[model samples]
Target chain A: MIGYLRDIEKSFPIKDIGKRRQRVLKGISFEIKKGEVLGLVGLNGQGKSTTIKIMLGLLRPDRGDVKIQGHKPGEIDTLRHIAYLPENPWFFDNLNAKEFLYFIANLRQIDKERLKQEVEEMIKRVGLSGNEKKVIRKYSKGMVQRLGLAQAFLGDADFIILDEPLSGLDPEGRKMAKDLIKGHKKKQKTVFFTSHILEDIEQMADRVLIMNRGRIIKEVHRADLYNKTLEQVFIETIEHDRNN
Target chain B: MIEIIKLTLKEAKREKGFYAGLILLFLSLICYFIVESFAMFEPEKVMAVYALSSVEGLSIILLFFLIFSFLSQDLNKKGIEYMLTLPIKRRDYILGRFFGINISVFILAIISTFIYMLLHLLMFGVCPFAFLIQLILLMALVLMLSSLPFLLITASKRPTLIAFLVFFIYVIGINLDDAVRFLSTRHGREIPVVSRALLKISYYIFPNFSFFDVKIPIAYKLSFSTMHIVFALLYGILYTFFILLFSIMLFQNKEIK
Candidate 1:
C-alpha cells in the first residue's frame, strides 16, 4: 500500500456521483498489490460493478484513469493478465462445459495442447469433473457459478477480477470458491473481487475497499486484525458513515 | 481472431432455427419459380426476374433472421459478455461476427444459385448467365445493406427500434425514388437529366435494391458490361467497410458499465 499510493491516486476520477447525464462511475478508485486481494463492498446503487468495469477497461471513467501493470486498464495487451467473472457470467449454453472452455481457450490464444491439459485441471479443481460434457444450460445455478469460477482460472492470468462469483453458489460451492481464492493468493496472483456477502469478503480478501455513492469511502486493512466477518465490517462501516 | 470466428461458427451451427430458416429459404426459391410459371408477363422473362430477385429477396429476409438469431443468442445465452471479457478487441469481435454471417449467407447463395440455374436450363434451355452475374453483384449489395442495420442496432443501446428504422428507411428510399420518377414521366415535362441523375446517384449510394432487379433480356442469357459488376461490388464492399469502421468507432467509446 505504501509504494502503490500513486496507483490508486491515478485511478480515482473527479466527477460528481449522481448528476443524471455524466454518471457511469464518478470518482471511484483504489489499488491493490500483486499478492493482495481487494474486496469491493457496497449496496446496490453504490457502483461496485461499475468500479470493476472501469478496472477491467470495460467502461471508461469520464474524468480519471485506472492503471493495471502501469498501463491503462482495458488495453488488450494489459488485459491479458486480467480475468473477469461478471455478475451473471454468460456461456454458449448449447456448448458443453469442455467445448466452451476449448473455445475460450483458443480466443485467449493459449496453446492448444496446453489448453487441453488446463481445461481438464481447472474443471477438476472446480469440482466439475465428468459433467464437463454436459450442456451448460441444464446446470443448476450453483454449478454454473462453479463453471464461471473454473473459467476465471483458465489462461492463468496474473490478475483475476470476479463480480459476485459466489452469489448463486450453494454453501458447498461457496466454500469451494473460498478455498480456490486462497489458492490464487498462494500463487501470488493479484485478485480484484466484489461481493455483497461481507463474510465471504472477510474470509477471502486481504484488504477491503468499500465503495459508496460511486466513490471509494474507506479501506479496511489491519492485519485482518479484528478478523471480524465482512458482514460485520460492512455494516459497521456503512452505519458508522451514516451516524458520522 | 480464429477464436472469435470459431466460436461464432459453433454458435450458428448449434442454433437449429438458423438452419431451419435456410431450409425455408430453399423452399421459397422453388415456390417462386412455381409462381413465376403462372405470371401474366412472359413466363421466361418473369421467371428470370423472380429467380434473381427471389434469391436476393430471401437473402434480405433471411439476413434479418440471422442477425436476430445471433444477437439474441448471445444476449439471451449470456455468451456475449464472455466474449467481451476475452483478450480480443471489439473491432475483431465485430469483424468476426460479420465474416461468420457472410460465410453462412454465401453458402446459402451458392445453393440458391444452383437451384435457379437448374430450373432455368430445364425451362428456357439456355443458362441465364447474365442473371447469375447480376444476382451475384446484387447479392453483395443486399448483404451489405442487411449487415448495416444489425451493426447500427448492436452498436446502439436500442437495437430493436434502430434496426426497424434502418430497414424501413432503406425500403422507403428505394420505393419513393422510383415512384417520384414515375410521376415525372406521367407529367411529360419530366424531371431534368441532372435531377434524375442525382436521384439515381443517391439510390446508387443508398443501397439501391433496384440494381438487383434483373427483369429484362440482358438478365436472361446475355452478359453485362464488366464495369457494372466490378463497380457495384466495389461500392458494396466499400460501404460495408465504412459501416463497420463506424460501428467500431461507436463501440470503442461506449461505457460498458
Candidate 2:
C-alpha cells in the first residue's frame, strides 16, 4: 500500500438485544490516497454502507479515524469538498432534473454560467437527452442513477463517494456509469464507490477494496483488473475467510 | 442567509397544490367577511367575532397545507435526498422550511385581510385602517404560535405520534380543572413539579386563542383595557421565541438518519 493505513477497530455492543448491529465489518484498515478509484466489494451486510457512512461523517466510528486529505470525515469545512450518494437515494419530486441540478449548484455556489454549461454537459453525457423539464419521478432506476451521478459530479469536488451506482442500470447505463467514473478518475478526483456489479468494478476501479465480516480482507489492484475477474478474486477471498 | 431564504421560498413554491390551497382559504375568508358584513343584528359583535376567529381559523387551515407541504412533501416525494447531498447545514434547511411556510402564510393572510377593507367601504364608507392594523398584528402573532410547536415535531422520531401526544396534552390542560379534581384525592391541592411547570408554561406560552375570543366584546363598543391586549401579544411573541430557540438547539444536534 503506497498510502498510510490507520488502526481501525469495530465491534458490536450488547445494545439491541434481539436485533443487534450487523457486525459485517471488523477492524478494516486501509488507505486511499489522492487519485484513487477505490471500488468497495462485499456481499450483502458486509458493512459497505456503514464504512462509507463513517467516511462521509454520517456515522462515527467506534474506534478508529479516517483521515481524508488529512482531516476527519465529520469536519464540515473539510467535507465541503466531498460529494456522496447513498445506495438508492430519494429526491424532491417537483424539481425537474435541471431545476434540481440548479438547486444543488446554487447550494455549492458554483458560477452561474459554468453551472449551466456543466449541468447541460452532464445531462448529455448520461445520455439523458432532455432540457430538464421532466420531473425525476419519470426517471427509471437507470435514469435516477444517472441523475444522482450528475449530482455527484457537481461542484467538481475533490472526493466523490457513490454506493452501488450500477446496481440497477442496463448495459448502456452501466457503460455510462463506467464512463463517468473514468472521467472522475481522469481529473484526479478520488472516488470511493461500492457495488454488487463485479464486472463494472473490473472495468473502472483503479483499486478494489474487498471486505468480509466487518473487515478489510484484501486490496486488489486495477493493473490486475484483467489478469483475473473481480468475481474470481472475491471467491478466493471469501474462501480464505472461511478457512481462517 | 438571504440566498438560503430565497432557496427555501423557491422550494416551498414548487408545491403548486399547497399554495393553491392556502390561496383558496384566504379567498374564502375574504368572501365570508364580506357576507357577514351585510348581516346587521349586533353587527359589530358579529363582525368582530368573525374577524378574530375566522382569521385565526383560516390562518391555521391555510398554514396546515403549507406545513404539510414542507414536512410531508419531502417524505412523500423523496426529494430531500438531493438536498442532503449538498454541503448545506441541516438546520439551515429546516429553518429555510420554517421561513418558507411562514412567509407564505403571512402573504396569504395579508391578501385575505386586505380584501376585508372593501367591506368597510361598501357598508360604512370608512377606511378601516385601524382594523387592518389589528389584523396584521394578529396574523403576526398567530404565525409565531402556529410554528412554535414545529420544533418539537421536527425533532421527534414520529411526527404524527408527537402531534397526537401534543393534542392529548392540550386537551387535558384545557380541562385541567376537572382532570386534577378527578385524579387527586383532596381538593386537587398539591400539584407535582412537572405538572405545575407544564400548566404555567402552557397558560403563558400557548397563543391563548381565548384571549382573542374577547374581540367581539371590544368591537361591539364594550369597554376593555389596552394593557390586556398588549400583554396577550407579548406573551404570544415571547412563547414563540423561546420555542424557536429550543428548536434551533435541538436541530443543532439532530442527525437525519
Candidate 3:
C-alpha cells in the first residue's frame, strides 16, 4: 500500500464555555495502492476533507493509525513523496505564480539548476504561461487554482493529494485539470483526490469511495463504472444511506 | 529552513507595515530637523532624545504589527497549510519565521540608526561612539522583543487577544522593576510573606524591558559599564531562544482545519 488509514477517528472541539467535541470521522478506514487514482466523493460535511487531512498528517486522528508507504504521515521521508493541493489554496499574495512555485520547489530541496526550468515548465503545463509574473492576489479564482495545481506537480511527487482540485475551474480549465491528472496516471503515481463532480471521478478514478455521515458507505470500481455512471451510483448510494 | 526564511523576508518586505515604518522614520527626521532649526533650549539633546525614542517606538510598533498580522493571516487563511504540507518540519517553520522577522527588524533598526547618526553628525558635528553602541544594544533588544509575537501567535489564534496581551506585557515588562520595588518597599514589614514572594516571583517572571532602555543614559552621556551591555545581550539571546523553543512545541501540536 502507498498509504492507508486504519480505524481513523477525529473530532473538533466546539469553542463554547463548556467543552463540547463534535466527532467528524467515526473510525473510517481505507487504503491506497500504488499507481492507483482513488476518488473520494461525498457531501459538503461528510468527513471527506478530514480524511484527506489525516492522510496528509495535517490533522491527527483521535484513534487509529495513518501511514504513508509504511511511515507515519507528515514524516519527513513520507512527506517528501507527497504533494497536496488544498480545497481553497492559499498562497503568499506577495509572490507571483512563478515565484510561488519556486518557493515550493526550494522547500522540496530541488536542485538550484533545475528549479527555474522546472517552475517555468510547470507554469506552462498548467496553462499559466503568460500569467507567471502576476502576483497571486491579482489572479482570479481559476488562475489561483491553476497555480495551485502547478505547485502541487512541481516536485514529481510519487503521491498526490488534491482536495477539490476542480473546484473553481471553468470547462476548459477542468479539461486541462483532467488531462493533468491523466498525465500523473501515465507516470504511475498514486493519486488521492476529492471532487464534487461525479464525472471527474468516473473519468479519472480507478476506484471511487462514497462517504456519508463520516462513513465510507459505498465503493465503486472501474469495472463497475462501465456498468453504471458514477453520478447514478453516488446519488443512489447517498439516498439509500439516508433512507436507512 | 533557509527557503522559508527567504520567502518570509520577501513577504515582509511587501507588507504595508514595513513601508509605514520607513515612512514614519523619514517623517520623524524631517520633524526633528524642523524642530532643530527652531530650538529655544538644548537643541542637540532634544534632537537626540527625539531621534532615539522615535526610532525605538516606531520599530517596536512595526515589528509587533508585522509579525502578528503575518502569522494571523497564515493561520486563519490557511496559507500555512501549503508550507506545512512540504517536507519541512514544523520547528523549521517557526525558526524560519523568527529569523526572517528578526532580520527585517534588524534592517529597519539599522536604517533608522543611520538616519539618527546622520542627523546627530549634521547638528552636533560629532557622533558619540558610546551612543552608537547604546543604539546597537537597543536594536538587539528590539529584535528580542519582536520574538514575543511569534510565540504569542503560536499560543493563541486570536489576533485581537494577542495584540492586547502583547501591549499589556510590554507595559508590564518595562515597569516591572518599579512595580516590584514599590510593592516590596511600600509594604515593607506589613506585607504578608506569600504576597512578597509573589511580588518577587513576578519581578523575575516578566522580561525586564528596562534593561534595554539605555536612552536616558545615552541622552545624559552617563557612564555605564561594558559588563552591563554584555549581560543584557546574553539575557536577550537566552530569552529569545527559550521562547522560540516553547513556540515550536505549541506549533508542533497545532491542528490545521
**Highest-TM-score candidate:** 3
Candidate 3 backbone collisions, by pair: none
- The CAPRI quality class of candidate 3 comes to high
TM per candidate: 0.86, 0.83, 0.95
Superposition error at B203 for model 1 (Å): 4.3
* Candidate-wise lDDT, in order: 0.71, 0.67, 0.83
- Candidate 1 on A18-128: residue-level lDDT in tens? 434634455555666887777888888777766666677766665665677776776787667778888877667768899888876776778977988999998998889
**Which candidate comes out best when scored by lDDT?**
3
Q: Which wins on lDDT, candidate 2 or candidate 3?
A: 3
Q: In candidate 1, what are the lDDT values of residues B1-257, reduced to their tens digit?
A: 66767766766666665677678777876687678757876677778777776677666665666676666655555555566777879788788887777666666666777788788889879876665676677567655765675466454544465557667756854575575566467552476778667666666556655544444545544555777667768877777788888877877766553
Error of 1 at B116 (Å): 2.8
Model 2, total clashes? 8
Chain B, candidate 3: TM-score: 0.90
In terms of lDDT, the poorest run of 10 residues in model 2 chain B is: B73-82
Off by over 4 Å in 1: A1-26, A225-227, B29-42, B73-81, B122-125, B150-155, B187-205, B215-223
lDDT of 3 at B79: 70
Cα deviation of A161 in candidate 1 (Å)?
0.5
- In the range A1-244, model 2's lDDT, one tens digit per residue, is 2133355655454463565654545677888767778888988877887777667665556676677666666555656778877677766666688887887777677898798898888888877776478887677777788888888887788888898888778889888888888888898878889888798887788889888877888888977656678899899999999799
- Chain A of candidate 2 gets a TM-score of 0.90
Off by over 4 Å in 3: A16-19, B184-199
